[model samples]
Target chain A: MESILRTENLCKYFGGLKAVQDVSINVSKGIIQGIIGPNGAGKTTLFNVLTGTYNSTKGKVYFKDRNITNFKPEKVTKLGISRTFQNIKLFKNMSVLDNVKIGFHTQTKTKMLDAIFHTKTYKNDDRICEERGQELIERVGLSDLKEEFASNLAYGNQRKLEIARALAVNPDILLVDEPTAGMNHIETRNVVELLEKLNSEGLTVIIIEHDMSVIMNLCHSILVLNHGQKISEGSPEQVRRDENVIEAYLGREE
Target chain B: MMDQVFSLIQKLRAKSVYFLVLIGIFVLIFPQLTDNQYILHISIRILIYMLLASSLNMIVGYTGQYNIGQAGFYAIGAYTAAIIATRAGYSFLLILPLCGIMAASMSAFLGFPTLRLRGIFFAFTTLGFSEVVRLTILNWRTLTRGTFGIPGIPLPEIVNFQISTNNHFYYLGLFLLVVMLFISHRLINSRIGRAWVAIREDENAAKAMGVETFKYKMINLMYGTFWAGIAGGFFAYFAGYISADSFILDESFAILAMVLVGGKGTLVGPIVGAIILTILPELVREIARYRLVIFGIAILVMVHYRPQGIAGAKAEGRRIDVEKEYEAGISENAVETTAPGN
Candidate 1:
């Protein structure tokens, strides 16, 4: 598998606490890579560093053969890397469609003068966002609630909406942190199906999950972390049999 | 009953063009309807406040940046117009945009460093900036004449048409207000407006979605303060005098109150607020001495009951409560799941 995103010895620290310690990850193109760990195992910290929300204390990140370390979050997004949050951060006041339309910010180019004068660029941008945003909302099965305020959506629907919003960026790779967190089994199954469908469409995904069944069923390759270090990395069968992963992450079987 | 009233408002909003035309005709024929100079003067005051309140809304209401020093930009615009018109003998046409530009540049200077500061810290910076502008105007004797102020400011002329009478100033102020509102409407409905709202909603999420939060915030600040300058320039010519006393901390608070009282996010909210607040005191001169108290009470009522102001979107207060509940629920779940691990 050809690697599209490679992090070389990434290290992010908060004073004396090593949140993500000397971790290197290589994610291949067109595959769903899973990162599984116990709570406070730096799973989210790694996502934060990869998405440029936190500047890595040391090491380098390369995306599609280009060095993109220490870039701003907006810049990373502009370069076609988009992500969702562990705690959903929807614009609660805005409509579902408006939230999706905002995801197209990097792609649109309507200047201040253009907007004031209602110029051709403004018309084109507005039309594109309206049509494409509606399409994306439909894709996520939120068409019926397109006009509804985001905060009004059910917990499962809000999770789907976040994925729809992330997909609005037309990203080359999607980094989703806990997409199924706090969801019931049915909601979790639906989310897993959605991720699988997206992956089938050739969209690479990097997922952080605590659900053992989700990681086992969805991931092409799984990496298990313990205490800010990668303890095991291989196929699900190999990881399930690994002594360190069993002791540190998945408790020993009865 | 409240739902019926809201539905009626919504219906009225649907035909807003007709209402605007009716209101326009009335305002145009208003000076003709009455020969009373005081009525025209009061009308002019409403128009000026409408401009100030709406411009400040762009920052405070729409973009979610707390600015309590709008009077600072107003002072900059007023001084720019006074200095240029009095000394350089520039026409009103030239001075108007220059006033906007001058205020906009000053806003950039202030916003660049302070916009990074969040919440009350950013608010205090604006308050501090307002005082600094007033003090500078008061102490700069050579340029401003200090306590004496710059008097005898010539009446503004547009291609030899002198704006002398209260009625004339009323028309000029109306024209400026319309221009400001038109531009604001255009910006608010477009991508720039969306970016501003995105920044206001969640800065981190907006950045994740590829909206440049800082750049958009700067744009919003400059766009808003530019109109504050225009209002100031209009004031200098309308009063035919310039003084430090006009732009004070109290003046900034007054403008903020107007935005809050009317409704922050909606276009018509500030206009309604400007009309009601500006006219209420004058209509009841007996209680005019307690004007600040009335403003305080009104704001408190709005914050507790409406939260979105008079013309704001319905159920905004309820939405906030829902968000808070959702957050609390999430935190509780987090605690339960992590309790045994720690």
Candidate 2:
């Protein structure tokens, strides 16, 4: 299968700190891929670099066979790649549905003049976006609370809403940063199931998760990082037994 | 006939259209109710400032861009219309849109590079722009006449009707206010409107969602300053004078204060702020210079207690909690604005 995303020799540095050095990843289409590393391993820096939040010192990022390296975040999104922040960056004061509707922003085609005239085109697009937002809210099990503010949601629901928002962009590849990071066990399980459902429906999901069990069971292939370098990339079982992966997670034995 | 009248009143209760029509009729006949030209003059000024404040709201309230140089744009519109009207001898209708375009161009020039700066930096840049505008007008003696000010601006004429009397200006102001309200109401519930709120809520998230923050900011500035220009043209003709003194940095803050006090992001906020702030000092004119002191106190009180804006708090009771919002990782001031588009 063709790779949905590819990075070659991706290097990011903060002064002398090699945040992410020589990290190459090829995420095949329609798979749940995970990036696992201990603290200071640069998983987030890598995600930021990939999503165009940070400039890479040296590397090329390919999305669906297009050179997308260092493209602005909005441009990167326009090219069919969407991402959610690990820190949950939903429009807090907006309603739950509006958060998801914002995801459909780039895909909609209502101009300012159309809006000013209250044109039929604007109305039609608005209705469709609302309906799609409703459907996504239902899919994420936020149907009953669609009218609530995003910030009013509980921790787990907020994470789920973030995912729902990311999914709203209608991306071929979804870059999720720590979706299950602060979620409870049950919430984590639901998220794992949600990712599986999304993947089964032809969405390629790349996750940066610290929750090891969620990664192990959910990701088809896992890439392990240590000191900003890729230590291992293989099937879940293979990554689990790898000595380098074990050392990266639990630290080197004396 | 009594029964029919009763039924008509009953129908008005169920349908807001009837209520609106009744208000429209009342407004049309309001001059008869208050024949005092002084009162009409104040009312016209209030109506003008309402338009100005609402225009500024498009940027400060809705787009979350701190623009403190609204008066500079307003001055541009005012001087542009006055100059064109004096030099070309045209109707205010033609001058109005010309002024808007002039202000919008200036706004675009300033906003294009400066909109990229975040928060206070952007505010100060606009502050500097406002100073630059005021000083240029002050020093350009041949064009603006400096402190002497431009006097004897001709009142606009529509066909045979001259908009010279207080009543004429009142009716004209009301007509323009209606036009502005219609435009803003329609625009606020549109795709571009949503993009603005998204940018205000979080620029990065908006960008990730494919909302070009810079483009939306420019549009926001253009829309905002466009109306300021229109109001400026109206003021130039209404006051029959144009001067740099009225377009000072203080005027910018006053308009911003109008948005903040009335409510930052709501449609109703600007009108409320304009009415309250414009009329407050006048009402307290019994104290003369102390009115400014009282006005300062009133604004301080309003901000201290109602930073969410008068309308935002009253409309939804969703006042912001800075610490809670910080913990949630989103600007709490987002609550200070309404997503009417949503």
Best by TM-score: 1
Candidate 1 per-residue lDDT, tens place, A139-225, comes to 888999999989789988888899999999999999998999888998888889989999999999999998889989999888887
RMSD of each: 2.7, 6.8
**What's the CA error at residue A203 for candidate 1, in Å?**
1.2
Residue pairs in clash, model 1: none
State the lDDT of candidate 2 residue by residue for B1-342, as single tens digits: 634743564466468577779888988998878878889999999988899999999899888999989999999999998888888787766788999999999999998889999999999999999999999999999988998889989989888778888998888888988888888788777778878888888888999998888998999899999999998999999999888999987788888878887888888788878988888878877765564455466667666765656555332333554555576544322311221111
Score residue B265 of candidate 2 by CA lDDT: 82
Which clashing pairs does model 2 show?
Answer: none
Model 1: fraction of the reference interface contacts it also forms: 0.64
User: What does candidate 1's lDDT look like per residue over B174-238, in tens digits?
Assistant: 98898888988998878899889888878889999999889999999999999999999999988
lDDT of 1 at A85: 86
Candidate of highest lDDT: 1
